[model samples]
Target: MKVYEALAAAFVEEGTTDVFGMMGDANMFWMNALAQRGVRQYEVRHEGSGLGMADGWARAAGRPGVVTTTSGPGVSQLATSMLVASRARTPLVAFCGETAWGDQTAAQYLDQGRFAAAIECGFVHLSRGDLAEEVVQKAFYLARTESRPIMLSAPMDIQQHEYEDNGPYVPSTQLIDRPRLLPDPSRIERARDIVAASKHVVIIAGRGARGSDAGEQILRLQKRTGAMLATTLQAKNWLYGDTDYHVGISGLFGSRVAMELLQEADCVIAVGASLNSYTTEHGYLFPEAKYIQIDTAPNLVMGNGAVADCYIQADANTGLAELTASLERESVTIEGFHTQEVRRRLTAPLIDPSEFRSQPDLLDPREAIVVLDAELPPELDLVLGSGHQTDFGTMLFQRSREITSNYGMFGAIGQAPLITIGSIVASGRPAFVVEGDASFLMHLSEFETAVRYGIPILVVVMNDQALGAEYHKSRAKGLDVDLAVIPTPELGRVAQSLGGDGATVRTTDELRAALAEYVRQPRPTVIDVRITRDVLSVPYRRLWFGEDV
Candidate 1:
C-alpha cells in the first residue's frame, strides 16, 4: 500500500467518515484514497471555509472535525480559521500536505510548522511511512485531549512511497482517557457556604456545561439555593424554559433586566464558564458579587481580570452535582432571587418598545428578527454571524433546542454561512444562518458548494447595504459614514445565480412568507431582508451612545 493509502486506512480506523476541503495536487491522492474507503468529502470554495466547516461540524456533532489541504498556499489559507478554532477550543484534525521532501525549490515549499505554531495549533509531521498510523493516531489524540485543532503534515514525496503493512491500526479512542474529576470535599463545603450566605446569587453556565448533565444539576442547585440562572453568549438559551428564575444570556448581548439582575448579584457561581471580559461586562457586571468558579482548570484570576474568591477544580458535571449534594445536605434553600416580581421581569419582552422612524422600503432589524424568529421552524439549527446584527438575533430569536452555534468567537464575520453548511450536514436538519450583508458577501461563493452538495442551509441576510457596525460607529463619531457604506449587489439574485433559491423581502410579512417557502421546499435559500440602517441595535447603542436599554 502507498503511504497515502495507509494514512487513509488510519483515518478510517479512527472512524472519520466526513471530511471537508478543496482538492489540490499534493493531497489529492490521499483525499481520493479516503473517498474510495467510503469517507464523505465536502469540497469547499476556500480552505478557510473548509476549516470553518470542520469547526462547525465538531461543535454540532460533538466529535473532532476533519479537513484536508494541499501544501503551501492551501496551508497558509487556514491561518485565520485555525486561530479561530484554537480560540474557540474546537477539536479538529487537518491533513495538510507539505512540500516534497528534500525539495526546498518546490513552489509550495514553506515552513508549515512555523505557520501552525503562529496560529497556536498543534502540528505533527509525518516523516516515515512506517509511522503513518502512529502519527495519525497522535493527531487525533491531541485534538481530542487539547480540544484544539491539530495539523498532520505529510510531504508529497513521502505520500507516494510504498508503506510496509503494519498489522491492525489502533484508533486513538483506546489510548484516550477522559475522566470526570470530582470536586474536593473541602472546596465543596466552601462553595456551599458561600452559596448559603449570599443574599442574591447568580449561576452562569458556559459551553462546558453542555453534554454533561450539568444543566440539570445546575437547575437542582438553583432550586436548593434560589439562584438565578444565566448563560454566556456561547451557551445562550441553555437554561431557557427550565426555570422561571432563569434570566436569558448574560454578557454584551444581555437584556436590560438580565444586566440589572446580574449587577445586583451578591455572589456568582460560574460553572464551566471562563468569566470573560464581555460576559462580565469588563468586571462591572457583578460589582458586589463574590465569584466562585467551577471547572477543570480553575484560575485565581478570571478572564475579566477579577480575582476569583473560590475555585473548585473539577468537571462541570461532577463539580456541580457534588456542590448541589453538599448544599442539600445542609438544607440550604434561600428565597430572595426567585421572587414573583423577578419572574415577571425575567419573562418580559427583551426588545425595546420605543419605535424608530419608519423607512420607505425597509424593515426594522429588531422587529424583523422577532418576526423571523416566530416564522422559522423551531427545529432548524440556528448559526449566528458576528457584527452589528448579531445582538439583534441573539436577543430576539429563541430556539426550542440547544442546536445553536455562532461565528462570533473571534469577532470575525462571513463564517456563519459556511459554518451553517457543516451544521446542517452534521445535524441532518435544516439550518438558518443569520448574517449581515457585509458578512454574507465574505464567503458568498460557498453558497455554490451548498447547492452542489444539496445541503439544506438558509442564509438570512440582514441587508443593511453597509457594514452596520462601522457605519453606526462612524455616524456616532460624526464622521463620513459614506466610507463605511458599500453598495452591495442583490444578494438574493446572487444566491439564485448560484443554483439556490432566493427571496428579497422588505416587510415582516414578506420575511415570514420567504421562511415558509423555505420550510415547505427545504433547499438552499437566501432571504435578503432589507433592514433600515437608521436604527441601531440595543447592544451597539449601549456601547457606542451609552444609551440605557
Candidate 2:
C-alpha cells in the first residue's frame, strides 16, 4: 500500500468525511486517492481559501477539519488562515506536503516545521512510513485537545514509500481517550455559596461554554438567583433566546447597560471564559465583581489583571449543571434580582432615539446597523471584517442563534471576504460579510471567487471612504485625519462586472429594497453601502462616553 493512500484511508478511519485543498504536485496523489475513496473533496482556488473552508466547516460542524496543501508556497498560503484558526482555538488538521526528504535543491523547498512554528501552529513531520499511523492519530489528538491547528508535514518521498503496515488500527476514541473532567463537589459547593451570597450576580459565558447546552441550566440558575445573563463576544447568543436582563455583549463592545450591570455585580460566574483584557476592559468593567472561573483546565498562574477569585477545573456543562442542581435543592431564589426595569433597559436596542446623525450625503453607519439588526434575514450567518464597522456589526447582527463565523483572534482586516466565501461553500448557508472599504479593497479578487463558484454570499462593504478606525483615532489624538483617509472606488460596479449581483446604496430605503430581493434569492452579491462616520466607532466612543473607562 502506498504511504499516501494509507494515510488517506487513516483519515477516513478517523472520521474525516470532507477534505479541503488545492491540487499541487506533492499532495495531489493523496487528495486524488481520498476523493476516489468516496471522501468529499473541495478543491479551492487557493490553499489559504481551502484552509479557511476547513476551519469554518470545523466550527459549524463541531468536528475536526482537514486540509491538504502542497509543499513550500502552497503551504505558506495557509499561514494566515491557519493562524486565524489557531487563535480562534479551532480544531483543524492541515496535512501539508514537504519537499522530498534531503531534496533542498528543489525550487519550492522550504523548512515546513519552521513555517508552522512561526505561526504558532502545532507541527509534526513524518520521519518514516512505519510511524505514519501514530503521527496521523497524534495530529488529531493534538488538534482536538490543544484546540489548535496542526500542520502534518509529509515529504513527497515519504508519501510515495511503501507503507510498513503495522498492527490493527485502534479506533480514535480508544487510542486517545480525553477525560471529561467534572467539577469537584466541594468546589461546586464553594461556587454555589458565592453565587447565593452575592446580591447582584452576572452569569457570563464564553467560547468554551458554547455547544455545551448549558444555556438552559444557566438560565435556570439566573432566574432562580435573580442574576443577569450576558455573553462574551465569542459566545454571543449562547443563551439562544431574546430574554430580558440579558445584556447582549460584555467588554469593549458591550451594551452600556451590560457594562453597568457588570460593574454592579458583586459576584460573577464566568463559564468557559478567558476573561481577556478586551472582555474585562483591562480589569475595569467589573471592578466590584469577585469572579468564579469555570473551565476544563484552570490556570493556577494568572497575570495581567485576570480576575479569578475562585477557579473550578471542570467542563462548563458539568460545572454549570452541578451549580444549578445544588442551588435548586437549596431553594435559592433572588426573585427580584433582575427586575422588569433592568430587563427593559438591558434588552433595548442601542440606537439613538434622536434622529440619526448622518453626514449630509452619507448613510449613517449606526442607522445601517440598527436597520440591519431589525430586518436581517433569519438564519443568515455573519462574516464580519475587523474594524470600527465590525464593532457595530458584531453588536447589531443578531440573526444567528449560535456563534458568528468571524472572530477577532487573528484580527486581519482583509481576510473576511475570503473567509466568508469559504464558510459559505463549506456550510452551504447564505452569509453576509460586513467589510469596510479598506478591508474590501484588500481582497477584491476573493469576492470573484464567490461569483466564480456561485456561492450564496452577500458582502456588505461599509464604504466610509477611509481607514475608519485609524481615521477616527487620528482625529481623537489631534493628528491629521487625512493620513488615514483613503478614497474608495465604487465596489458594487466591480462586483457587477464579475458576473455577480451588485448594489450601491446611500439610503435606508435603497438598502431595504436591495436586501428584500437579495435575502429572498441570494446570488453572489455585493452591497456597497456608503456610510457616514459622524458617530465615532464603539472603540472611539468609549474614550469619551464610557463609565467603565
Candidate 3:
C-alpha cells in the first residue's frame, strides 16, 4: 500500500464520505484513488473555496471537514480560507500536495508547512514516507483537540512511494482534555445572587455558548428562571424557535425590542458571549445592568474591567446548568417572564396597506427577503452574508428554517458565498446564498462552481449598487453619501455567461414571479433584484437615532 492509500483509508474509517479539493498534476494520483475507493471528490474551481466548502460543512454537520489541495499555489490559496475557519474555531483537516523532495527549493516549492504555521495552525509533515499513519492520526487528533484546522502536506514522492502494512490498523479515540467550566464558587454565588436579585433578567447567548451537551439545560434554566432570551448574530439559532422569549439578535443589527430588553435588564447574564464592543453598542445598550459573564474561555470576557460584576470561568452550558439546579433547589421563581408583548410591539408586518399605493419600481431589499421567506420551502437551507441583508433576513425569516452566516468573523467579503457554495455541495440540498451587492461581487467567479456542480443553489443578489451599510452611515452623519457607493458588474449577465439561469427583478411583483420561476427550473439560478439604495438601513438605526453625545 502507498502512503496515500493509508491516508484515504484513515478518512474512510473516520467516516468522511466527501472530500473537496482541486486536482492538479501533483495530486491527481491520490485524488483519483480516493474517488475510486468511495470518497466522493469535489473538484472546485478555486482552492480557497475548496477549503471554505469543507469548513462550512463542518460548521453545519458538527464534524471535522476534509479538504485536499495541490502544492504551492494550491496550498497558498487555502491560507486565507483556513485562517477564516481557524478564527471561527471550526474543526478541519486539510491535505496538501508538495513538490518531490529533491525539488523542495524549486521556485514552485513554497513551504506549505510554513504557511500553516504562520496562521498558528497545527501542521504535520507527511514529506517523509512510511510514517503516514502516525502523521494522519496526529492530524485528526489536532483537528479534534482545539477544533482548529490542521494542514498536512504530502510530498509527491511520499504519496507515490509504496509501503508495507506491518500491522492491522486500529482507529483511536483518545479522550483529550475537553474545555471545562471552572465553577468558581464565589463567582457562581455572585451570579446566583444577581439572578436572585433581578426582577427582569436576560440571558444573551453568542456563538461560543452553543452546541455543548449543556445547551438544552441552559434553555431549561431560562424556562425555569423566567428569563428573557436573546442571542448575538453568530448565535441566532442558539435559543431555537421558542419565540415567546427568543427575541432575535442584539446590537448593531439587533431588533429594537431586543435592545430595549437588554437596556432595561436589571441583570444581564452574558453567557458564552464575549460582550464585545458591538454587543454592548460601545456601552449604551446595557449601561445599568450588573453584567455576569460566563464562557469556556475566560480571556474572551470583553466587559472585563468595568461592567462584569461576576465572571464565571465555565462553559456556558455547564455553568448555566449548575446555576439552574441551584436556583431550582432554592425555590427561585424566575417565572412569569414572557415576551409576547415585545413581539407584538416589534413585529412590523410588511404587507402593503393599500391596493392603490403604487409599489416602487426598483425592488426593495427588505420586501425581497419577505417574499423569499414566504416562498422558500420550510426545509430549504439558507446561507446569508453579514450585512443589512442578512441582518434584515435573519429577523424576518421563519425561526424553523436553518440559517448560516459569517457572523463570528464578519468582514473579508466575497468569502460567505463560497461558504454557501461549499455547504450546498456538502449537504447535497437545495441551498440559497443571499448577498448584498458588494459581497456578491467579491467571489462572483465561484458561482461558476455552483453551475458546474449543478448544486441547484438559488443566489438572491440584492443589487443595491453600493456598500449599503456605509451609505447608511453617511446618511446618518449628513455627509455626501454617494461617496460610499460602489460600481457593481451586472450579476445576472455574469451568471448567464457562466451557464446559469439568470433574471433581473425590479418590482416586488417581478421578484415574486422571478423567484417562483427561478426555483422551479432544473438549473442553478441567480436572481438579481435591483433594490432601492434607500432600503438599506443599519440595524438598530430605527431605535438609536438622534441621541446627543
Best by lDDT: 1
Per residue, candidate 1 scores C-alpha lDDT tens digits across 1-549 of 999999999999988889999889889999999989999999999999999999888888888999899999999999888888898898999999988876889988889888999988999999887888889999999999899999999998899989999698889999978776878899889988988899998999888786565878898888888889988888888868678887878878888888888888999999888888778988888888888899887465776676688899898888888888888889888996888899888777776546644477798888888888788877777888888977788887765555455636677788788778887888898888889998999988899999999998999999889988999999999999999888877778888999999989887778888889999989999999898888888788888889875
Q: TM-score for model 3?
A: 0.88
By TM-score, the best candidate is 1
TM-score of each: 0.97, 0.93, 0.88
Q: Per-residue lDDT for 265-315 in model 2, tens only?
A: 888788877777777788787777778888877563232355477788988
Off-target runs (Cα >4 Å) in candidate 2 are 164-173, 240-242, 300-307, 398-400, 405-407, 543-549
Predictions ranked by lDDT, top down?
1, 2, 3
lDDT of each: 0.86, 0.78, 0.74
Pairs with steric clashes in candidate 3: 181-314, 225-334
Model 2 clash pairs are none
As a TM-score, model 2 comes out at: 0.93
Worst 10-residue stretch by lDDT in candidate 1? 399-408
